[model samples]
Target chain A: MQNVTKSKWWQTMILKTIAMVLIGFIVFGPLMGTLLWSFAEKWFWPAAFPQELGLKYWKIAFTGQSPVLDSMAISITIALIVVVLATLISVPAGYALARFNLPWKRILLVLFLMPQAFPQLPVFINMTSIFYRYDLVGTVPGVIAVHLVISLVYSVWITTAAFKSIPVTLEEAARNLGASRLRVFFRITLPLATPGLIASSIFVFITSFDEFTGTFFIGAPFIQTLPTLMYTASMGYNMQYASVIAILLTIPALLFMLVLEKFLKAEYISGLGV
Target chain B: MQPRAAVKRPSIRVSDGQREAVSGLVLVLPALLVLCVLYIYPLCASIAGSFVSDEGIGLHNFAKAFTLYGTDILFTIGITIITLVLVFVVAVLTASFLRFRNWPFLNFVYRLPLFIPYLIAGHTMRVFLAPHGILNILISRVTGLSDLPGLAFSWIGLVITFVWKQFPLATLLILGAFQSVEDSYIEASLNLGGNKVRAVWEILLPICRPTVLVAMVLTFVSTIGCLTIPLLIGPSKPVMLPIDMAFRINYMGDWGVANALGVISYLIVIALSMYYLSYTVKKEDA
Candidate 1:
């Protein structure tokens, strides 16, 4: 009888190589198209690769000719504000939940985690009307509010996990040495949790930076971010401009997340886009 | 200071328990306040607004939504289901590869799209999947065949884009679970004369089933909620719910129908999650 259970070594090698090539294409193929287009000044069908490659579109983007620079600045500004605000709000709460016997603590955890369960687009749809009442629609404040809500999923959870990972005994030991509670926290706890805190802040910044549905609903037609700008550029089939913006929007996120993948918990990393 | 004086002074120094309680409350309130004001308030408003309409507070808006965009709702569900299945398949294969293999280039490439945002993902897919786009050109050149109808601006485009975009996150989650599972399990199966495929199928996958399910559910939920993918590459005749909901609001200025549709999507997520939660809880209890 022929052995059907095992493949030959060469067959396995071939299969593995094929799988890798397929995976590589599936992963990098679209991005390559975008990258090529970003440089392509004139490229038509029947030819593989760009007909002409130049920095013409890139110069337009970099020289503040298009709204790309403004949009990029605005996106960074909003992401920074949201990251700081989210960090400020999440730190104490995360520490409290991790260390204290707060009332309805379970409910609070569930509430913080609620964004994972809820579909966000609808809430944003309704938010437009609600924020409109307060003159927040199409304003930076309104957009920031939306980003803050989404940021909570990562900020609160990661912050809580960060604090929780530090042993309470360490804090208690410091406390027994005649150290004040605030002093113990500042010195003992915060230092230990810095890695997680930094990761959490980066996560918030990434979320707020890439945020589209919320920003689109609450801030479009007035506020323009890299994502919103990319959307318009793509809509017009301005492939060169869109591709340039796409590359801009992508690089920081990839770089930060590569660093982030080391410090953040697997669970928190998975929580992204949830 | 006498005890009576302390009581009369209303506690110049509060009790430890009381102090802790206040501290906990103070520390916890700001995050909760943000959640309440930004998330909870608008969510409630969406639900509440769906009810009040021209006629009265009822399912009138729901009935209207179903009548107008019922096909789009179904289309959304169909795309979600198709995307979930494809995403699940891609996630499992890629995650298993990452776990079982030590290919450095594979590792680096797999993670490239993981952090790319949705809108950017949409545009890239829009171009790459276009009729005479790069993918099509490559296929024709390789196979020596022409007349390849492309996937862009159709259901397949949406599926490919969703799977491609979601692949990294889903694989990361599944791969994380796979990593936690000890090598001994797979080694045990292999020692018993089981093949690598069998070892992975029987040992590794079963151990990581819960994470797989959660990953699937998350992908499903987000796929339904996705507006960017469909808007960028959706078919004109039957669209997804988000696009439909957007049209109702942007074009028609119909908030009632939008909220109704929103509630419907919300209910779908809640029902699935509740089932998952109950299943996990019941398993833990057992």
Candidate 2:
């Protein structure tokens, strides 16, 4: 029995070590490759690594010559706008859904979720007429509004969980204590659910920031976001420029996720029973 | 508990009329107005345009998109299947590996691509797999081969890139699903003398069946409507549906046909999403 147990333990450790190496390869392979390529000078066929490496492409991408700056700026603006608008729209709606026994809740849930499942291509094509009619195409706000359709759904889903996590007894106690409804809300409820709200907003921001399909359809030739610029740079066969901007755009998202790491527990978001 | 907390204070009361009006305006009015102006109206216009014939009301646009040059449809279907299969197989393996392993840094590394946008992923691969690119160089070095294989600008490369970009998300979802399986079940399987492969197949796989289905459905819908990867690496003969639609609307200025294609893609996506949404909702209720 001792021999069997000892051997089994060793076998399990070996299996674990092998699994670790496999995961390491899977994760870092593409990431390190991209990072290396970003700094390569004339990295083309026949060279395993770049013969000469420099900061030339990074300089161009940061300067006015590269479209990345404008694209990044516009993407940030649009994402923030989407986050705020979605919060405004979803907060009360999510609260009602979570707290009240409202009629048509199921139907409303379906309606709210309908846009998420539907492909953005159809919506983009459909919005062309709106663009022409209202002269809304190619504008940053126009792109932002189109993005809100999806971002709003994300905000609603995440915020619903946030709101549901707030206990009912707290609200009832505040009501009974002669505190006005507004005081109870802004003080107790909002502060308590701030983490969830922030997490949901982060999700909305990421969704809008990384949105490519709608931005391509609406913002082409006019308003450039980071993804759109990345597309154009790559389309022109400027791989160096694309890589530089790709790295630049990825930085902000990674930073945002890191900052919110303490609050936005993956289990919390997933455990909302969604 | 505070003695005052149990009492329902009637001092801070609002009139019922004001309450009703505020509720109506707050809950229903803005949403109804926005839907009318933004979503409902545009969709109606697009639907109408799709049916308008050269002369009058007809299904010419739909017919053209549906039947005219069926190659686009075939290409889209083919690429979608390829992407789905590649992503699923790779994701399952990666997720399984992560579950059995305790490499925190490796887990973090696996998620790096999730932060990178699709365009960046596609473009980086486009460069690295160029004829004179790293992939070909490595190939030549290993085999002592002279001719550089420029496989980057092909269907295989596109599928590979798609799998790389998407597998992380699939792995994460499946990993979550795997974690939900009770440890007792695995212990019981081991006690019964089941081997690792058999235990995984019979115990873990069956338990994670729903999540696996969810992952597959998500992959199918996502790949079927891809615009970036196909545009980047795919050839000219067989264009994916999204690329073809973009060409018609943007390049050729054929809005009606583009909208028709869009509607078809939308229907497929919506059907899949509804299946997932309803399934989850039902599962939660049960």
Candidate 3:
């Protein structure tokens, strides 16, 4: 028994060690290269690695010379705006989805779900025409409005799951005792679903913030975002500058993801189960 | 009954009866309006743009599409399929491995790819796979190879970049599904003389089947709409659909042709989504 247990423990330890190494390499390989390239004076052809390193690229990225800082701020602000608006709209809709049995609910659900799969490029192109007509393309609100389509769908899906978890009996009992519907909803349902609401809102923010194609196709040149700026720097052969912006832009997202992993128990839509 | 009689009864409906319905509508109106303006309107406009021509209610745009060398469209469809399959396969394997081992660090590693946005992934791949990038330099130093050929602007490079970008998402979804499998089933399979592979194929696979399907569908949908990977790493020959569509709008200023292609792509997306939804509903019913 001792011998078998020892072998099993040894095997488990070996496997775990291997997994850790692979994981580290997988994550840090490109990241390390990116960091090295960012600090390097020049990443030229035929050089094995950077021989010289300095803060020159970082200085450029931070200064008013590059639009990296401004674009990052715009991207985050837009994402937050979308998150707030999407959560506000989706909470009530999610309530209707979960609690009510309205006809055409299936249709509504499908409509919400379809956008996730739909190709966003064409929609952007066509919307550009409409934006051209209405003069909403160049501004931040125009981009935010377009982003809300995707953000709202995701928000509704997640928040509906959150709202569904509140038991009907609690609300019914409150109503039976002369408590108002608004009172029950605001006091009971909203509080119970707070965690889900928060999780979904963060997801909305992440999606909107990370959005590249729509920001490129519709809000490009005039309203630059971080991803678009990264694309431009890389395309313009400013590898060092691109890497700096890339690392800088990626930090907040990485931090948010880590925090989320701690609280958002990785069940696909866990809040939906009542 | 006696308790009920002792208490005063209250009215169920509020004084602002009609206003409640209006409030609900008011709450939903903005989102619905945006959806109509953005999604529904663009979709309609694209279709209208497709049909507009001097030829009088004819299929001119589609005729143009048919004649305009559909190799790009075909190439894109092929790439989408291959990327989905490869990503799904690799993801399932890695996820299964993680599940079997229950490795903590593996979870973090598997999710790291999600942090890099698609554009960054494309750019990173370009840098790493450039002619004088680490890939070629390593090859030269290790094997004394003079040239590490076909690193950039190649089909193989495009596939590699896409797989790298997409695999992490697939792995996460599959890993989450893998976690849901009970340990008892594995023990049961083992006791029945089944090895890990057999156990995974029979027990674990069936349990996580729905999740795998979801992952596959998402990856397919994502690849179909992608433009960056192909533009970055793909060869000049056999142009991909998204790039082609963009070219039509930008270079040619042919909104009609561009919108026609968009409409076609949208129709395919709708079909795929409907199929996925119907399957899900049926699965639930079953």
Number of the top candidate by TM-score? 1
lDDT of 1 by residue, A168-192 (tens): 7787666656677789889999999
Question: How many angstroms is residue B153 displaced in model 3 relative to the true structure, after the best TM-score fit?
Answer: 2.1
lDDT of every model, 2 decimals: 0.85, 0.73, 0.76
Model 2 spans > 4 angstroms off: A1-25, A64-66, B1-25, B28-37, B193-210, B270-286
Per-residue alpha-carbon lDDT of candidate 2 for residues A91-166, written as tens digits (9 for 90 to 100): 8777656655555656665566655544556667778657867788888778987888767666776666777777
Ranking by lDDT: 1, 3, 2
lDDT of 3 at B40: 81
Clashing pairs in 3: A161-A271, A161-A272
Cα TM-score per model: 0.90, 0.86, 0.88
lDDT, candidate 2, at A216: 84
Residue pairs of candidate 1 with colliding backbone atoms: none
| Cα error, candidate 2, residue A217 (Å) | 1.9
**Pairs clashing within candidate 2:** A44-B132, A45-B132
